[model samples]
Target: MNLNLRNAIIDNVSGNSQDQLEDTIVDAIQNGEEKMLPGLGVLFEVIWQHSSEQDKHEMLQLLEGGLKKQ
Candidate 1:
């Protein structure tokens, strides 16, 4: 993702409440629409970058579990 677009998403999301932001993220992932993928990727990238190693490991584990269920 371009830095400008990433910044734009951060700016746009900054106004949202935590629940709303989570809902938006969950919806995007659940829907799995083509257009939403890039935004989801950006979200994941941003999260992965800032997360602690333990948190990242937990997240990856959760992701693995979710993938296994599918």
Candidate 2:
């Protein structure tokens, strides 16, 4: 058996509008289901790969702040 989760997730969400993407993300977070984490990680990977250095830095800072709040 073989599974390529990242590609599968990407394919599922491909061609979705911005509002649809936001709904998917928000629903995944609100549901707090473990299965959705991989999809979220894949989405984040896409975002991170395309982000500018400044964007990356800001994302890291936001992540750091979120971690500190925990």
Candidate 3:
């Protein structure tokens, strides 16, 4: 079987408003289902691609802090 998961995810989430996107992310995290991970990753990819260097740095810092909390 051939599957294009990334494109599928992008297509699914395309045109979503900020609030709807937030709801999708929050729901996925709160649900904590492994199936939702790829979707989250796709979202992160979109964010990373569009983020400026400073935004990326801030995200890295936040990610580092979250990792430390683990």
Candidate 4:
């Protein structure tokens, strides 16, 4: 994803409250389609960029666990 677009999504989520952000994410997931994948990827990228090393490691672990189920 382009850096600007990624920043924009981060800004949007950051501007909203946690509950709202969760709702947005849930909606995206529930509505999952090919089109939604890019958005999710962008969100993951933004989160990865902003997260601490430990947080990133934990996220990677969680993702690995989830992927293993697929």
Candidate 5:
């Protein structure tokens, strides 16, 4: 079967408000379900595509710090 998962996810969440989007993300992360990853990745892709260099740098720094907490 052929399915456009990225577009599907985007379509699903396209009209959400900021608070709804935040709740979606928080719920996905807190649930820790692998099935939710693609949606999260799509969300990140949107964020990355729209972000400035400084914003990307700050996000990378935060990601690096989070990853080092093992």
Candidate 6:
């Protein structure tokens, strides 16, 4: 069966407040379940798409720092 994970993730979190969204992200990361990665990717994609150039640069810098530690 074909599935649209991006839309599904968005639908599941629809109408969530900022705190709720933060909780969802924190929970997913803390859980570290492989299943959660796609949802997180979708969320990150939304953030990336809407971010300003400077925001994107900072995000990339953070991501680079994160990868260096791994």
Error of 2 at 52 (Å): 0.4
Runs in model 1 with CA error above 4 Å? 1-3
TM-score of each: 0.71, 0.96, 0.96, 0.73, 0.95, 0.92
Best by TM-score: 2
- For candidate 5, the TM-score is 0.95
Task: Give per-residue CA lDDT, model 1, range 43-65, as digits (tens).
Answer: 78888999999999999999999
Global Cα lDDT for candidate 6: 0.96
Select the stronger candidate by TM-score from 2 and 5. Answer: 2
- Which of the two, 2 or 3, has more TM-score? 2
Q: What's the residue-level lDDT of 32 in candidate 3?
A: 100
Give the per-residue lDDT of model 3 (tens digit) for 1-70.
8989999999998999999999999999999999999999999999999999999999999999999999
Worst 10 residues of 2 by lDDT: 1-10
List all candidate RMSDs to the true structure.
2.9, 0.6, 0.7, 3.3, 0.8, 1.0
Worst 10 residues of 1 by lDDT: 1-10
What is the per-residue lDDT of model 4 for residues 1-70, given as tens digits with 9 covering 90 to 100? 3478656666767778878877987888998776767667887777888899999999989989999999
Local distance difference test values of all predictions, in order: 0.85, 0.98, 0.97, 0.80, 0.98, 0.96
- Per residue, candidate 2 scores C-alpha lDDT tens digits across 17-56 of 9999999999999999999999999999999999999999
lDDT of 2: 0.98
Badly placed stretches (over 4 Å) of model 4 are 1-14
TM-score of 1: 0.71
Q: Which of 4 and 5 is ahead in TM-score?
A: 5
